[model samples]
Target: MNPLFRFICACLFTLMVLAVAAPGQAQGDGWPVSIGSPAPDFRLPTLAGQSKSLSQYRGKIVLVNFWASWCPYCRDEMPSMDRLLKSFPKGDLVILAVNVEKRIPEKYRKAPVSFDFLSDASGQVQQRYGANRLPDTFIIDRKGVIRERVTGGIEWDAARVVSYLKSL
Candidate 1:
């Protein structure tokens, strides 16, 4: 066995082991909410002038979405979010759409909003969740552990997404 060949083989084996041991590791880098992390608790006002807290949804799957009314991505994804909310049973899942603005826009206050439209006027709750991007979303499991974190906009009602939520 040549010395150089043995060294190269050993390095390749080590790299393969590391890669298999740490699948999906890059998904958590720089993300405020990571899979397996406890979802941060927050209390914020709802569009109807009522205050709501994350703890209230314990033992159920919760989707915490941080968005601003003016964000185009947020606007685009909202309809899909509504559909996602409707897909679940009344108490099986809770979707908290936290508005990161001073006032809940009239458009959002009007008809067809199914989820809990929370008002994070001071951005405190958003900051607590580390939601740096508009339309950031965290899916928490029944145990209140964040199972998934998605940045930017995505179709929340997509079949695959719905299936994943159901599995949790």
Candidate 2:
């Protein structure tokens, strides 16, 4: 094998290893909060003008979703999320959709969803949660410990996902 080819292969292998290992070890800025970490508490204004805090939902299973209206994936997964919220009885699960965009889109303000939509216009709460990516979701258990961190869009209302959450 050529010397240059060997060097390239070694570098590629190193990069692949780092990519696989990074998320499990990532902390602080620019990374999603690791699973099992305490969900970061924040109080943000709602579209209705009232403010809500994560600590207030400590006794309930909280689904903290970081999303933007401009992201198609975010929009696609929203209905599933709404269904997920509705599947549980009131107070069983608390879904807080934190909008990271500077302006809350008009459509969302009018959408009929029981869960609260919060405004993180300054992105302080988003950064604190390390939700640098759109459509990041953290499932915080009743005791306020983060149980799962899901990046990208998913079928949140799927039976398997809902069942897993119910078991939590």
Candidate 3:
């Protein structure tokens, strides 16, 4: 092969490998709760200006979502989240939405979000969840164990998922 063609082929092959490997790359600090490890506690301020601790909600199901206002998927999932919470009898499930400050938009600045919106501005909580994607969610059982996790955005209010949520 010609020298230039060989070099170009090498570059193309390298790009291909990187492209395939990119899916495993860390999108955030890689904070998705793993099995057998305690979920890290965080004290994040709610949109209402009150602070909350995950540990404080022991014995209740928690749906923790790492999201950003700019994420179209996050935007799409918000209404369902709102509806899911409203459909519940309150205290059965709680949402801990942490806006990764770097990419979040300003429009999401309000309080008493149908559920709860927390901030991971410093990425402390983000780092804890091994969150590699936006709208990543973990369904914590009432006993505080992470039961299920969605690395990509999820339609949590789907009939099946909602039923599962209700069952939890």
Error of model 1, residue 114, in angstroms: 0.7
Misplaced by over 4 Å in model 3 are 1-32, 102-104
lDDT of 1 by residue, 1-168 (tens): 999999999999999997886655453343345578888787888878899999999999998998888899988998898888888988898989888888876887874868888888897777767798889999999999999889999998999999999999
- Give lDDT tens digits, candidate 2, residues 1-168: 999999999999999998998776645544656678888778999999999999999889999999998989988998999999989998999999999999998889888778889999999988878788889999999999999988899999998999999999
Q: Number of clashing residue pairs in every model?
A: 0, 0, 7
What are the runs in model 2 whose C-alpha is more than 4 Å off?
Answer: 1-32
Error of 1 at 115 (Å): 0.8
lDDT of 3 at 92: 82
TM-score of each: 0.78, 0.81, 0.75
Residue pairs with colliding backbones in model 3 are 30-130, 30-131, 31-129, 31-130, 31-131, 32-129, 32-130
- Candidate 3 displacement at residue 148 in angstroms: 0.5
The global Cα lDDT (0 to 1) of model 2 is 0.89
Query: 29, model 1: CA deviation in Å?
Result: 18
lDDT of 1 at 135: 90
